[model samples]
Target chain A: MNTMNNKKFMMIDGLPVAIEGEKNILDVIRKAGIDLPTLCYYSALSTYGACRMCVVEGKHGEIMASCSTPPRSGMEIKTNTPRLQKYRKMVLELMLADHCRDCTTCDKNFDCKLQELAQRFGLKKVRFEPYSIWDKTDNSSLAIFRDPNKCIICGDCVRMCSEIQNVGAIDFAHRGSKMEVTTAFNMPIAETNCVNCGQCAAICPTGAITVKNDLGPLWEDLHDPNVRVVAQIAPAVRVALGDEFDIPRGTNVMGKMVTALRRMGFDEVYDTATGADLTVIEEAREFIDRLENGGKLPLFTSCCPAWFRYAEINHPELYDNISSCKSPIEMLGSVIKERAKQQETGKKPKKTKVVAIAPCTAKKFEIKRDEMQYEGEPTVAHTITTIELANMIREAGLRFEDILPEAVDMPYGIASGAGIIFGVTGGVTEAVIRYVLGSSARDHIADISFTGVRGFDGLKEVKIPYKEQELSIAIVSGLKNAENLIQAIQSGEAHYDFVEVMACEGGCIAGAGQPFVLGRAKPERADGMYEADRLSNVKLSAENPVADALYTGLLAGDKAHHLLHYK
Target chain B: MDNKELYQQIDEIINAQSSEKPIVAILQDIQEVYRYLPREAFDYLSEKLGVSLAKIYSIATFYENFSLSPKGKYVIKICDGTACHVRKSIPILDALRKELGLSGEKNTTDDLMYTVETVSCLGACGLAPVLTVNDKVYPAMTPEKAIELLGELK
Candidate 1:
């Protein structure tokens, strides 16, 4: 990952850099320092090119969206030309006439990109009259709010939901002026396995999506000194927390991260990796038990809360096939409380508070589930996102060196390269092979890398032979992939012995609830995972000390199987 | 409203507008006449010769316009699009309980106003908010619209 080769990057107008194969011209322009105005363009998602604001004058003398247009050699691109400006103005004027321009009371008032662009283009007088008007908001879900009047019909939310989240729960229902993005039949997002990652909101050019921020509650809790608060940081957060502090991406400041958390008023700083270690022990045993006995063959991983919710809503038939394992973040909280009782940190077990600092927005919703909520315990107290954590870090000035890299408590910090890879797509499946199949049989599998399951595609599948057994596996990254996969499974077309489904593209590293990167900077920051995985000393889940310790302690072998395997 | 009066209002609106832009506008009015746009409008448009009837007809077909056949009096158009689907629009539709005993554009009860047609998106997404009674875009349209609009026809 450290090795950089001299690669040819496509030029838009005239910018050059190392490029991936067949990249769009807009990406090339942005990669180079040229900023082009666009209403529908978003990084971390496929471009729709619906809004013509990003129009660039081509060599052919026609204006086109730089986002969707592919770049070629020696092509002349003109951005913000007089002709382009006139065209953008015309489109803006038309949009403004019908748009509800009461920005003061608008939910997205300060954050609306379309409103800012309108002002920039000086679109005060609209040429057209209002066609039809509908000003209303659907506040059905706890996490999502749908303000149709705010939507510019750019299709970013639709595409993000379909392509990135892989949840086709929402789509462009009608065509033309009547086009609206909605869930199947306008149902509340909560009913579906939306996971509420807020990635849709992240990609939205406008404020159509928002996280149901529980900070208000956390603030109230933090003031209560009687409440002993302990916060756990997820593995992926260490890699991206620096981005929140205006630090560059791929900077692994693990030591400074702990210090930052401590300064942020977290009485105790914990690691979600420890919980991830616990997941390995439970999962490995479950795999062995399932293989030996005729339980559910090739059980799917349920680490992703979004994927789990999707299964519960759309693919209820496969619910039994899914491992009922709580996400590593949740598992860590559960384990922390159980262990804290032994340590007796001056508080009763009832009053102990736990918070998870995660890169996923879905973790917010996952913590609220009935299963995650124990009868008496306050379900993981609070979930502060990586973005929020970084903000807290900056709020308190602490050097990265000031905070030494402390081991993630006991029995949980021990994760292998395989466990660390869980932050990426298909990492769970590959990790399972390391423990379940072992290294000797791993060579026979001609394709060690499942290209179909790898990369940023919506859905992928592969068949691998381990010893005499031929295992079929499916890896679904987003909700739309889940929809298509479920439909195929119901139709009896797509068959899989085991499946790994992540709610967001690129897994937890690109989780819906992670830190926000604006403009075209998202894709450029996508390579953070490979670097993190590469730097880890232990690369497999089986090798994690936390997993070994959990097996040796607390879980007396037989009880571990009963508690985790569900046999 | 009597059929003669309805036709008279249609004529008045048509005659009042300039002959230039009203070509498409007049056809739109005829569409409101028999629950669906009529074939006579297409023929008249062809004779108008300014714009081809085929082009006008193509526009009509492209949109959620009515068919050549007669329709019920209370034309009930349901939006079966995606947003409404997630909202469980089907069961709300099922609450229609019994079909209006209608076929094509017309129904058996002769209330002809109650013809059921499924539409795409009607803009009012926040309202999700489906539309009924042709262009009367209802915001936050519930199954209650089915009962309310149907009662108006009766």
Candidate 2:
């Protein structure tokens, strides 16, 4: 909060900088355009000053951890001095001594903070030898793996899970030299109540935790001659995958991704947005029937699989309220598989394998669930993160930027703006509001956007007049925020007609499966989704002619209910 | 004890303690009931206290007083301080372990009758070469005397 009207000033490296409303000295130093290297600092989490790399010199020749120390007015803080520089280097060296030095083969090779800091400081040699406490890596979880040997013990992942998600699947165990992060009783992660959200992997500063290698199975599927590999891209993936390819951040690179997939031997590429439209239509229908026919109120949206699983495990009371809609990728995968197996007019069917490319690690877990399977067969053969898909593109030796853009294949290519905007927080509620309003007109759509269901607010409440009655809606991202809302609802302090929960803050745009993103870069991805929506011809889900054609043709009778929803 | 009994006792302990850090207190009571923290108790306590298994396990492992495995009915504590070591406490510890047929990481007997352990001190430096069975101290204890004491207790 470096404001113009503020009178508070602090000398950062002999330069007077306005303190404004900055609570911590680290943020005050950041106002001066220089950041101290810290492995344990995240803007969204509580101040954990474990990593002493952010230490600054005080006027009285004292040292202070800038992240936890409060910024005082007229304070003289030297951000970088000879003593501080030497101390920082020593800290890095000491942290490196106990850390795993195998960086070249590590998943977080270039992305690792220690590796980056070592290169930044031109560290040629380490005076100390590596002595690791834990040697085994936990590969029991399908979505992510934890390598205890590489853990720097920053406690960022710990805070992110317990404080942010309100899910304490892992915590620091033991003491002193033998301390390690692990599940309760040191059980395998698969045995714990881990929802596989991948936020822990996303927040891990080293290769301590990361998404498991998934390209092996995908490549094997592509190479098998008898297998028909169909790929469906999630709505959030297209906007953020460009972060890996160095195409401008948050740019819509779906076409290039489609081209890359086609070259890598995908039989068909479909947009999961079309499936999101199905969610919008079905979720709205359920909401209206509940509103009119006296059913359970506050129909919770079930688009985010991580949120769905969290609710499934923790809040059994809200089971009836949670919509039975399968996630967009699952919905679309079921349709693709059903169509592939059908003996239709244009049919040369082999064993079909539906691969979902999503910006979610939990989708991997969701695909393997018992309900998502029909008659002992999974709706989706496999789910790969956006990062894994990018790796596949690079492995295929294709120049992504030079490749021509291509459209998703027919039968499910065309989608509504309502579907495309489902990537961001409150985007689903706004989409549902538009459908409930029963309008495709530009004015009505614009009015719905103004109903306070946009932007990156953790929790937003909107009450819209539906017919003669008012429909109350609450949209929240992050499980902690959902926990607060759930508590309020259970205690009878609040009520809403619809509640949408996204486990990750800022929705799928900031999903852990996407490239490493800081808190600031999430809005850019949100903007990309809105921009894509603004450019689409069809503004409403029900108005999309392709969806209308779907209802009349392929999804006639109980087929739509069977394929698009979880029973 | 069965899981239901353990869970009920844990609940009783929790209801009585009602403190901020009740897990440690509840664990102590459960250990008193079964002589060690049972595996099933960790999962039950995790759900009952709304605390993660990691947090409870950390507490259970952090304190040296709590044992994860079952301790024998008659626990043996041999003092190994400088005074006791000079008075030949090693032979007494070895004799007890050998008598119980326990070695290396094994401390408890197969019949669960005796557990042999060495403590740094027993606060009785004057009683050098000391040992304790079930907190009943035996001062200036010799290897033969310890074996004879164990045979009498049995």
Candidate 3:
């Protein structure tokens, strides 16, 4: 061991562990493979010592929060002492006393961290008297649900919204026992400027915040014979759907997912990536036109529903700068409805139900927006999260791992590698670049891969040379970074020809509706998406034969102009 | 105050500070003008300060001094600290609440004449069982005395 820089060592449970300037004792202990229980401790967010679950005894028998306490040299720490265990048990007991212990009915029943910790610590009973203080459940938002009773006042949601997304739609209100995470004047989340990102729901330790369930209507539509329920699965969902099963994180279950959806009574299972391919074609054309002629420079990609809503509410002046293109799922819905109805009635579709399975809760709200509809009927009728889809699969008694993988339905199912990468940040820009360069001056570009735009960075800036002119592109994931970029653009400090923004940190793969992993699963999931792209036969959107056929045949002239583009 | 005048006052308060204080200061000033923090004021501050509505609202609600709803003309606060609790302050609080017709969670009356609230401590421990009506203290208050004071205010 190279103990180069005055590295201190600490004894944790009588084992000497070398600590190299770690922030806290808890982190050091965690590094040593001893996973101390934490309720209010999120690695990304600020260390909130509100919950005393991570309390450990020091050398002098002083109880301190390990998360907030710094590791000192020659310090003796006792993490799992009987006294500390008793203290932690009492804390959990008190937390449970006032909590709504309806575990069977809770949305986060199996996955809730609080419940898992309690079970792990062998808490058989809570001696404290049961009491209920809060009765209000704010289901005001289209996506998020807030039950104040289940809240442990962890402040994770508050911090995540404020710090990570820069949209503090909910925060700690009042003080002490009366304190709660609520909107202004206890206003419903819908009334406030909540973008329906559902990050709060994703970070919630309990069922205090959860994505609104739309499984009932979906199930009804699935069972209905009159309704031709067509399912469109987003690229991100495939990379994350395996987490719901015992499958490891970042496992691509695309074929199995399609087969599972088909078995769950979906009339047709289509890929949202096909829609993404169409998006690339349309957006690239728009970008090229804007570059050649005079239009909004640095056109922002209008895909991530959460980012779209944030821009609309927070920065309406820049709305014109956003590309007037519907998201991949929305485009797929339009295609399915138009084509399905045309095939059925020899005219425009009247009643083809398009359901999208996505790794996003914001898609639920996006589908309900007025802009998302055509002729007063919503293009996407229903949006279900990946977790809900997994539940449906489990409910249907389908063995996801045991079942053989199947191909997706044709026409709307064929997609290129460019489309699959749309699940991660900078994918839309890269795909558009590939399409634009591949279509025009193909021989000039030697390497088709645009490695500049790919990564898990909050903000990425890249300049690519196309023929004579250089295209300046910025890829931003997370709304906070987007906010900064917007400010920079406004101040004339930065300029770009195109910008790709995704509200979630790692784009759709790490969406709030995806399976909740404690640590970030963005890098792994992004790798999985990249692997899918690598295996894809068609690397460019312009080269997709299905898209070419669609453009030349069904989506010819005014049909593509209407169905593919949105204002 | 008129919207223009209120906004002007808010602007002056914001400009008066050398460095920006926490949002509580702005909220407190707005509350001072309208007797409570108004939605319009909150929205204006949010726009001017470039702070999210949720952040401002959180700060407004966290403090006991700032009220989101319209408060009564005369606010009454009864001390319920350890000293006053031992000195039988519960009877005084009950008397005031009954007289004001404010029970349960209803701290403010329908007429908006009086609002009764309990404080952990008014920092008047020597004068135990103390109550204040719009900054005017009434120490060593009996139930009858508290009722008489409220009746006189009415």
Candidate 4:
């Protein structure tokens, strides 16, 4: 066995493959085109060998979990055998006996891993008698819905919330037959400190956890003749929404999406990136004001609703440190409402409804927050996830792929490259830097792309020399990383002028409501956003003519401060 | 106890233990004082211990000893282990339930006088079909004998 790069060559079935310090035999087997079936195995999470489907036999006739078993030098492994297949089939049969098999009505009918595995393993019949362990569906959360009946006790949601997000709002309770993933004291999820991140729903293999469907109310409003329905698409939605229409991941389908919205009866289609453009300018002003007036250092970005809520519930002391600027979607909603009221002359004008298409389920809850209201009514009338938007397009019987590309409506449609990059992890900080330099220090800096803050790293820090002063900034994705950063700041171990925290791993590009793409979708979608930025004529928010017009015309002085800023 | 007194007691229990003491130890102390883990006590402990309420709830529910609901003054433990199962401890449990007027789901009586529950083992297989009323053990228990013991308690 020849060693290459400290990796020992091993024979699997017949072909010789190199195993380079792989912790488990499964990784080596997968590298050699011997894909093993697994249910509870997620690459992003810890290895849980509860499911015995990935069992492979060694030369010594020992059947072991490939996920947990380490590979040996010159080891011969048989991933597929008669006995192993039989065992896998038996496991699926047993799981099916207790599972709620209402596939036609299930939200995850076509997407369910269990159903796919059943067909792959050729499970013709479940011989065991049905033993139902159904529990009442939990719809207490505005963002997420939980159906315990559909849950296979995979512990994916539990692990995702606790291990990744650092929000243990739900955990496994009881043991054996009574075991279930529940909130504190089995209370409703809304009663708990759940930030409504919808990450639990996103990571769930089954339809046990899902984003709450509010399509009914949205459709009703769309059908109403009295309601002037308009749609605003989030920057992240453009990059990932293509996945729903069988398009490739990271494909920017903004034009196609806008056309689809118009076909689905939207009176006018707009871009939330325009709102992001406004945010860049406003937040840059705030940062500059604070820098000059000796205000709070390290102003945290409040764009992510999940991060905002997490701060409120978990770390209330840091509440004042968060930026008062409203998120891009909310900012656009406020702008749209103001524009609608201005357009109307006298008589009670048609109720202008602003429907926001976002890649976040938290936006569903964000729109309903008391602070997001204008004149006793929500600025954003309804919020729907990208997945929900896909369903609406399909329900309207429109061929998304064949539809001609259409441009968004005027006033709230045009956005700069700074606004386009807001979908990615460090894009907010980068955008702010671009805005500051593009407006003031254009002669000093050449390259606008701040590559230091970019990428999928859990936490990234950069110190930039701006106007003869070093400005320290930290960009953090994943709430666990945010928790660590906060702890470091609290312990006086680390300090920064500004911090950007996105609760999701790769910001809104990999949001919970986006179509589930396996294997490194974050960097790919982020690349798409960057590509869009590179192709744009206007690279800075300060250069956007519409933003300049809005600031100079309507959103000026105290009115702008009142509408754009939040507590 | 009053809300203020209960909070103070929880605080006392938590303060008595070292900072590095595990949550289970603190929870056990609170359970002992309240007879069950109170919601208020959990909220207090969450803030004090810097542990999420979800984790605390998980720990409280995982153990068979912990009860979220209040228990009766007297706890009747009937062994349902292999030896006791073959020797017929079910009839004794049924008889005790009938005498105490406690249903299967409602383990504790309305008056809070008695609570009936089944145990996997009592570590005394030699005395099969054993049942315990609080700390006192009744060896070689029968349905009639268990009923008689309950009557004596009243």
Candidate 5:
């Protein structure tokens, strides 16, 4: 869409465009589709003009930066003259002098804009030998990895982390050739409130920052006969997985999703939502216990791993207050191993490999936590997020449409309407309150859901009068919001009895592991999640069959004692 | 404080900087208490802070504001933003160079302790020819004040 200020718009090589009032000639040229090649010029943010890649010849004799040079009334710009292209390619060659180019294992391999630009310029290799011999690949963070040797010094990660994520966990630390991105005191990201949103990875043009891939492990398990692999799908996976298969957003292919997993060689398919129901049971019971016993009043939900990690780093004082209950994925891993042992009777429990089909990239890290290891399932193995799973399914020649909807296997299969809300921001806290608030008041809590915490408020607060006790609850989604809330709590500014926090902005549906949507495409697809919630018949946690069965069969009346409550 | 007491104080400052980000601010504050960044002080910092010696060196070298070596009894800072640049602050810097016989990035001559460096906009553009001695700003500075300030150094 052209800005209204395009009245002063001009044609550049047959492309019509408008220029912002103070936009430079390079900006106008880029907007006009006259691809003025730039090395340091990053789109979607401010231009630093550190690399003179976008140098173009103006109508006058002076060579100017397309990024920094402001447009004149009638300036004729020459973008791809031989002299300019040569200068741009030479800039790449200089940047590549120290760039690590092992494309096969590179996280940015096929997706790298820099590599594509190099191919576009038809450059074979770096003309100059390497400089700055140090190659720093810090794997301290669970999700995002930074390899400074591959960085072109474009500052995209710095801009995205600071400008977009609001967590300037990274910045240019040193000067000139010795410059590298470092956290506070140059500590590893695990020591900071990084939140693992992967926005930095999204904005990075080179192989500098990338998400760690674990799909290879999932593939190995898929082919292993000794591994009894069971796959559980997260609620948000159903909403966004369709988009990866080129289907419309919010397509309920829950049945087909199950079928695809079976075809992919999984021994069993279960719903992570089933485990979500289990989570609701444990979480709700924990909430009620806190309310009655004067335990931590407003207990923070531990469903989101990134949020948990952030709290562990930023709010160590509140560590004891965090819900001891594992996430749906981790809970499912526990149940899978437990059931495998139970079913084997006197025989030794077979090694069960559990894979979580999640809507989050952070789930990849959650299953790897040391505390999550189950007895039989020595490794709570691989995870494939919605988009990645879709890619793998396609690579395997399996069509999601051909897959049939099958019910999740029992024990932890059923979940309540409240459990279904776990996909949303405050769903976990609300669901916990509905199911765990003791029998006398559970019915008195009313049929209507507490929708105050439902929407996308970074830090949402609500006070519920449950029976004789008032439960103070706060739901925080997004790491940036978590940071603000933690800081407030740390400084004694904001206080809450219990908090539900998810590290992703719009909760799991808008997770970093969700399908890629360009900047212009997000707002349109953003509301697709609310529609998914609306279409589900079961809206409350009390109504879930899985929870009912777990109570009646497994622990009898002590379901709350067995599964609902944890550290 | 003597050099050993100064070293102990610097150790406290560096320990704070290593364990917490908030502590780096304290390090800046202590730099005022002690005229310069002493290497012996960093040794105490390394022992207390538990940070690697190389890392402390890296951090010290990175920030242009920090001084790893001793300075003259006094320090001078020149603002090099657009406003100060327009005021020909270069002449004031040149005057310091002529007076101190310092030609490069570092200057350690005589018993005098002065480190002159440039900084970005300090949000005081109206005070164009501003120069800072210790922490106090001398507004509308002239080349004469640059020399006079050096003479007043302890």
Candidate 6:
């Protein structure tokens, strides 16, 4: 594969750039600092090249899409010639003609790629009339909003959902002008087995698909002096929230985040990592019990809501294998609500609402689940994404970057390194491994990190010797990888003692509700999670005092079983 | 249909076409049994076959012959292919629709007696303008002739 003996060079915009092993001409040009406008092309997914904006002129003045074309040894590629400009402009104008341009009030107003491309291409006016039949918005889904009118029909969302996630909840329906990205029978997406992952929403370049922003309702609650609102920040959010404030990606902004939330009327703020510690301990217990007592092998971690739902509906037989423990968010939510009900915090509101901040869209729907609900009301009142928290921070006019560092409130704030690592893929397994092998097993802990169990890969496998048994583990992010692993297990091709499934590829850090990333938020955010873990004084979940107190105190007898475990 | 009975009927069709590779064959068999692809059938097939409902709907909608809604007892298909169009098939289709009180959107009549639809071709191009009633080809038809033919059928 290394054809390095003969060097290849491709001329992009008349500048000769050496191409090592780049797949497409677009990649070569992009590596040479050319930011080509593309709507349907994502490096994570297969090349669609339908947008036609990334067209480059060839040697014979032939136009070819740079995204789909392979880079030749000495290919002449002019990115921005007059003809290319004209074509790109026309493409923009055509897209604009039917684009439902209420740009000032669109969900993706400032963040839209289509809007930026329109501005970049300098589309003054559309030559063609608005020929599209305006469709009504689909607001049926609990987590996602679908406005078909604003869609440029970029297949990024389509590929992300179907190809990347292996959840074909939507696909190309009808033909020509009537064509649309729709669920079966043009039914409401909530009716389908969509899993509510929102990876499609993450990849959607336009506001056609967007995560449901619960900010307005949150604002109403914040304004109401009666309601005591508490916020729990996910470990993933701490690393990524800084992206919105330009405070460098992967920087832990938990302290500043706490200050911002308090300023914005949050009565208490806690870290979900402490809740994650509960999950690791409980899941590990469940796994060990199953291994000992002839229960289902390969106990699936149920921390990921999207993956949990995916298995619940699609592979119902695996229901027994999935861990009974609630996700970190739900576990914390239950504890917070239960505590609020037990201890009367001097009653103006009469009700305490736990508003969890997560780097997930599925978490929105996760809060609404009947199991997540305590009596009739949800344990978590509302689950807001990382971006929504940023919006609130911006609304409060707090200088997030310069805010004085503040600690998270009370007993729930503390979490171990193992818990913090739960933000990224393969982290849940790694954490469980660290828990099973005690904190003192430093050499074994170092060995686990090297044994293919701590990377951002969509699918990872590792085996560790424990007692008499060799505990085999498989960690998968993205539904496609999960689906593949499931098939292998079903076909007797694969066997594992444990499996961790995260619906979003590379886990919560690259979730749909997080900041839109062009490439996979791997090494950057994954490294950040690992770095945060390294800096934590306590390495194992067992070592965390907060978790230990929970195991001994609050979570005792039937109450712990009821609060932490979901039936 | 009730869930059990609906599932029962679809299960029979699936079992019949169990060895069949193409989903189209199963769809065709179901269409034969039910006269149109039921929305419920999509739900059943998608789950059983592991093919997406969106893709099933797409294939259903793509083919002009495949119908999503239930069809009428007397199904009238007027060919509007190149030869048929040149030979004035539109007037014949218009006459049938006008007589049956059917519009573009409303294909089936209120009485459930008639459904008038346009097709690309019947592959009987030598007949110039042609229309079919329940697959019985009527050759060289005019507006008056089409109306007369409908009257005879009624």
Which numbered prediction scores highest in lDDT against the true structure? Answer: 2
Candidate 2 CA-lDDT value: 0.87
Candidate 1, residue A128: the lDDT equals 80
Report lDDT (Cα) of residue A151, candidate 5.
Answer: 85
TM-score of chain B of 2: 0.92
Q: Quote each prediction's TM-score.
A: 0.67, 0.92, 0.94, 0.95, 0.70, 0.94
lDDT tens digits, residue span B35-113, model 6: 7887888888888888877778877877667888888878989999999999999998888888888899999988777
* Model 3: docking quality category: medium
Model 3 per-residue lDDT at A2: 22
Tens-place lDDT digits, model 6, residues A409-456: 887878988899999988999999987876555556667789898776
Order the numbered candidates by TM-score, best leading: 4, 6, 3, 2, 5, 1
For model 6, the superposed segments whose C-alpha errors exceed 4 Å read A1-5, A345-350, B1-20, B121-126, B134-136, B151-154
If the candidates were sorted by their DockQ against the true structure, best first, what order would they fall in?
Answer: 4, 3, 6, 2, 5, 1
Question: What number of clashing residue pairs does each candidate have, in the order they appear?
Answer: 47, 2, 1, 0, 19, 1
Estimate, for each residue in A1-567, the C-alpha lDDT of model 3 and write its tens digit. Answer: 224366788899988888877899999999999999999998888999999999999888999999999988888999988899999999998999888999999999988988998999899998887555666898778898888889998999998998899998888877877777888768888998899999999999999999999999999988887788889989999889888787877889999988888888898999899999999989888888888888988899998999999998999998888998889998878888777766886444435799999999999999998888866889999999999889899889998889788899987667898899999888888788787777552442225444577777899988877769888999998899999999999999999999999998878888998997536677888889989988887878888888888888778889987887777
The number of the candidate with the highest DockQ is: 4
Better of 4 and 5 by TM-score: 4
Q: Give the DockQ (2 decimals) of all models.
A: 0.03, 0.61, 0.71, 0.82, 0.09, 0.69
Model 5 lDDT tens row, A318-414: 7778888878787766667656766774454556777888777676677677666654233468877776787788889987766667766555555
* C-alpha DockQ for predicted model 6: 0.69
Model 4 C-alpha lDDT per residue in residues A173-274, reported as the tens digit of each score = 887778888888778898888999999988888889989999999999989988999999999999898888888888899999988888788999998989
Write down the lDDT that model 5 would get.
0.69
How would you encode candidate 1's per-residue C-alpha lDDT over A118-190 as one tens digit per residue? 8888877887877765846667665556777667778887666656555555666545776666654355666
Q: Chain A TM-score per model, please list them.
A: 0.78, 0.97, 0.96, 0.97, 0.79, 0.97
